[model samples]
Target: MKTSLQTTAFAFATSAVLAAPALADEWRLNNFLPETRPESAQIEKFAEDVNTALAEKDFSIEVYHGGSLGLPNTDLLRVVPTGAVEMSLMWANYLGRDAPALGSVFVQGAISTVDELTDVLPVAQEIYEEEYSEWDVTTVGFVAIPTLSVSVFCRDEPVNTLEDLRNVKLRVWAREQVETFERLGVAAQIIPQEETYVALRTGVVDCALYPALYAKTISLQEVTGYASFLYPMASAPYALGVSDALWESTDPEIRDAITQAADDLWDRTNQYDADIENEMAARESLAEEGIVWSEDFPESDRALFVEAVSETWKMLAEEAGGNALDYRERMLTALGR
Candidate 1:
């Protein structure tokens, strides 16, 4: 009953429908840190830049901070490559058991200065890429946090030497710190940063192994009057990881844009060696807040601490168990230590 003209038109409509491209849903990026941190701002800017470049693409990005999407930090290595989550900023030190290779890559006390840390980062980045690829993910970017210097802040008196630390309870952040201090014969315990102020005020701990730059955050000057510099606080920077599936599917132009944005982030953090400068400024501010600073933690004692920490690093590599020793040696070589 249909005319030839009508049949032809129907055929043309079906062809057009078949030729249309399928648009993708918004890609989500999970940030495990609070929105208040400076690094969050940098990440948001990265997303903004990438989205701008991706305006013509079928896909876009939306960053979710503080794990609002219920993605667990500990399970990132297992979950990231499966494409269940498209992208995430992973904190390596927190994932010791989930991915030992990641934890073995680096730690907080690895270096004594930001410059030294930066010098060794090229090697570290390589390890990160290699380890993440095994999980079927690609490294896209890095978010460098503030370089807070590690120090001991005590409530009433100056914690000057090894013996002073042994006299009063010392609060530390992780097992690494606990082991390092215990090896030096100091009584130390793991106390969460958020609860540190309350712990110090209530006499639960007499001293805390904290960062001077961050002391102002919890107003440590109020509870702790004495502080001493220990070393440059170093840890693995948050890594921006993309699922290999998603990365491979991306258009080349968009992919380049993402890579450019990530490169910009790395350059931003290292440009002026400004993080250490900021830490120095914060120390001065803490002093203004009535906190007295000291350099009485002698080089002799520091050498002992570093030696103990080095042993812990080896233990971490052994637990990781997959050419982790090679990675450690490469890192040590880069550090010239």
Candidate 2:
């Protein structure tokens, strides 16, 4: 009996020793984008950087990209809460069904540039945190792709003016995009980004609207001939949200390390966009690679487009059940509008 008691105590001590190592060394993170694209490349880099930083502190992390661990793009909010997965970089707009306020952000055409968003991200972050926390999610930091400036990349007909928007079959990614483009008379069809090139090549779509980064990343410039500089009407940002339960379980030091690295990436991304000289250089490079950019549409024409969508603010406010109106007032008050 004495020998058996000693063996039992030894086994218990061994189990405790094993559990301590598990607590120190293992982690899993998910990124939903394909590695072929530039923005996705940046996300991969961020993950690698985090892993490297943690390793320097005698820890390690495993990163699953392209939704390798699971279809995080569609199921993370569900999976994360149940501990099916640990961490993720979530795009707010895609989670619209769960978080309507996210989609509401795209309602107005006023926030045209990254510079404008920089001032407003704090308020947006606060709003998202409040909403996401209900689902047991936490936002680590936001990663923005340099202006998702939508371009009408057409196969046969290039859209140069507002009149060209009429009856044009285009691919749209968001409901707000559909509504706003429909108001401009576009025959919009919703489709995923992966299918856009095939849709354009097969004549299923006459034109498609997406970011310059996407165009450059996927060689969409080869299928389309011209781009319209519709600045405000076509700009957006992507965000990254983490699983709150996972965050709470993480060692506070590891959590701080990841958050700090993500914050650095945000600053890097913002710097990349804020450097007008670099953006101009990128534009020139893309132009050299067969992308045609038109300078024909002047400020007055741009103003006309904004004027045409003048009721967006009111419509959005109504859609947001007065909260959007509150947001709008906040933005306007910030700008002294």
Candidate 3:
């Protein structure tokens, strides 16, 4: 009787051990964009989707927004590879100082529309993956936050021609924008986006070059009176990267689940960009705020702007070295420029 009782106890212990779940591998994802932005909302959805897809696996992701994680937006390239952060949504142009080749995606006239961007995305992903691998990071996905166009919003006067932009202090971001504006004979001021409203209101800068939706979000329309539709600057693409160590250690199934979630988000981004509701909301906001909108630039002016930006691209490619130039050429070819 004693032997039988001991055997039953041992079998129960074994069953309990076998039924226990494995420890979960938790990952942290960082996005520097404000939580209210559509991009940040999409990142949150991605985390939820990934969790759902990997429900059976011991994998999870926790998201941090608005720089809460203490990682500077510009340092993602350095930090992501060291496993200091498990994942990040990094802007391509932020790396221009060190790797100008990565900024080729934001070449002003390279890709103009969502359709064009969608067509070139596969090639872009391939190029980006190869470039980022040098930092021991793997590209899981890419997103191009939609804008009506890269526009020029002026405080008092309208910017309708290249001549109109002459000597005008316009807020700019990224090295490409500075060079492009320089060629166009505009004074480019590198102002933080958060500070742009006060800059415009106080006349620190005469105009700003940014997306219309963003301008509305920040109440920039309160100070700006007119907007000019410039040639479609390719949306500066954002990449979602995973640390190489985490990626390699993760189960293949978990990796696929995470990748699928990202790919689905990528596929849906185009629709989101084209959503009429979002477009109408932006229009309503601008109208309510009483910001005047200018018609598109004349073809002649548009052509000249494109020409000036094209020259800047050539100069940037040269300055960035042989590989950078080669990457630009490949992107141009892929983009059918």
Evaluate all candidate structures by whole-model CA lDDT and list the values in order: 0.76, 0.62, 0.74
Residues 1-337, model 3: lDDT tens digits: 3234334434443343224422448777888787877888888889999998877775788888877776666666756665566788988777775567776655756566676666676676777888888767898887767745667889988887778888588898677778877777778977867678899999999999887766665677788888877766546568899878778988898889889988887876645346446655675678677777787778998887778778877888888775677777876787677
Over 4 Å off in model 3, which ranges? 1-24, 55-58, 272-281
Top candidate, metric TM-score:
3
lDDT per residue (tens digit) for residues 46-141 in model 2: 777787878867776566666555443544455445434456667766665545555655453656666566676666666666656766777777
Q: Point out the higher-scoring one by TM-score: 1 or 3.
A: 3
Q: lDDT ranking from best to worst?
A: 1, 3, 2
- Against the hidden reference, what TM-scores do the models get? 0.79, 0.79, 0.84
lDDT of 2 at 243: 61
Residue 288 in candidate 1 has what lDDT?
Answer: 93
Give the TM-score comparing model 2 with the true structure, all chains together.
Answer: 0.79
Off by over 4 Å in 1: 1-25, 56-60, 68-72, 145-147, 189-206, 217-223, 294-296
Q: Which candidate is the best by lDDT?
A: 1
- The local lDDT score (0 to 100) that residue 90 gets in candidate 1 is 81
| lDDT of each residue in 1-337, candidate 1, tens digit only | 1133224433443343224322364677888766766677788888888888778775577888876666656667766665556778987776665566666667667676767778888898888888778777899988776666788999999887887788999999766677678888999898766678999999999999887766766668999999987666676678999878889997788789889988887777544367678778888999998999977588788888888888788887887788788888888898887
